[model samples]
Target: MALIKCSECGKEISDTVESCVHCGCPLGKVIFNTGNSWIGVFGKYIITDESGNVLAKLKENQQFEMNIVEDTTFYVQCNTSIRRNKVKVCVPAGEINKFLVKLGFLGIVTVVSKID
Candidate 1:
C-alpha cells in the first residue's frame, strides 16, 4: 500500500486504507496508472483518489543511456499523496523494457494496447 496524504484532512495515510485515521475520511482505493503502457519509451504516472479524481501526475524528466547502462527518471507532482511537492523516481530503462522481450517473437502477430 502506497502512503499518501488524505484528500480531506491532509494527513498521511495508506492508499489501500479504507478511511483516514485522523479525519475518518473515506479513501476507498487509490488508482495508479501510466495512462498508456503500449509505448513505454517515455514513462508516465497518474495517481487518483478513491473517488476517481486525479490527485497527481508524474512524467519522465530525462533519460540517458550508454553501452549497457541506462537511466530513466520521473518527477511526481502531487498535492495530497506527495505533500504537494514534486517527487522523483529513478529506474533503469532496461529493467522496465523487458515485458515484450519475455513475450518472444511471434513473426506474424498483431499488437493491441488497451486502457483500463
Candidate 2:
C-alpha cells in the first residue's frame, strides 16, 4: 500500500485507508491529490438569458470564484474596452464543453480592431 498525505489533518496514512486515522476524515478516491491544490481551470462562464443583461463578470487579476464542474460554464467578460484583451481563461476538469454551449462563447475571442 502506498502512503498518502491526509488532506484534513496533514498526517501521513495508507492509501488503502478510507479516512484519516488521525482526524477521521473521509479518504475516498476523489480525495487523491485533489484537495487545496490550484487546479488552474474553470468549467464555464455564466451569462444572462435574454435582453443581454451582464450578470457575472470575470475581471483581470481576480481568482475565479465558481466551482469547476463537468459541463460547467461561466460568463467570461468580453467588452469593447481595451482592458479585455488576451484574457487567459481556464476551464476546470469536466466542465469545458458545457460552458461553451451555455454561454455561446464558441468563437476564439480576439481584439480584431480596437475601436478608439
Candidate 3:
C-alpha cells in the first residue's frame, strides 16, 4: 500500500488505511489501481532517469507528440499480470559520434574513409 499525505495535517498515512494516525483525520475513500498491470490498455507507464520513480500515467488512446526532454527508459508491458513484467529500452542522445568512439566503431569508419 502506498502512503499518501493527509490533506488537513499534511501527515503521511497509508493509502490502504482509513484515517491518519497523527491528526486522527479521516482519509475518506481510497482507490488503488489494481488493474491487470501497470501498463494496461488504457494507460502507459512513462519512466525517466531524472527521477527513480514513476513520472505519470498517460491517458488511454491519447495522441500527442512530445519531444523527450532527456534520455528516458520506458518499461512497457508485453502482457497483463500482477507481477508487471516488462521490457526496458534505453534512448540515447542524438550525439552519436561520442557513442561510436566509445564502442570502438570509429576505427571502422576511419578505415572505410581511407579506402574511399
Q: Write the per-residue lDDT of candidate 1 for residues 12-103, one digit (tens) a residue.
A: 77655566779876543212233222323433344333344544544433222111122434333322222233333343322222111001
Model 2 residue runs over 4 Å out of place are 30-116
Taking the tens digit of each residue's C-alpha lDDT, what string does model 2 give over 15-116?
666567898776532100111222124522323323445445333222223322122222343443324333323333322122221111243342211111
**Which should have the higher lDDT, number 1 or number 3?**
1
In candidate 1, stretches whose alpha carbon ends up further than 4 angstroms from where it belongs are 30-116
Worst 10 residues of 3 by lDDT: 107-116
What are the lDDT scores of the predictions, listed in order? 0.36, 0.36, 0.35
Ranking by TM-score: 3, 2, 1
Error of 2 at 110 (Å): 33
What's the TM for model 2? Answer: 0.26
Q: What is the TM-score of each candidate against the true structure?
A: 0.26, 0.26, 0.29
Provide the lDDT at 48 for model 3: 26
**lDDT accuracy of residue 104 in candidate 3:** 13
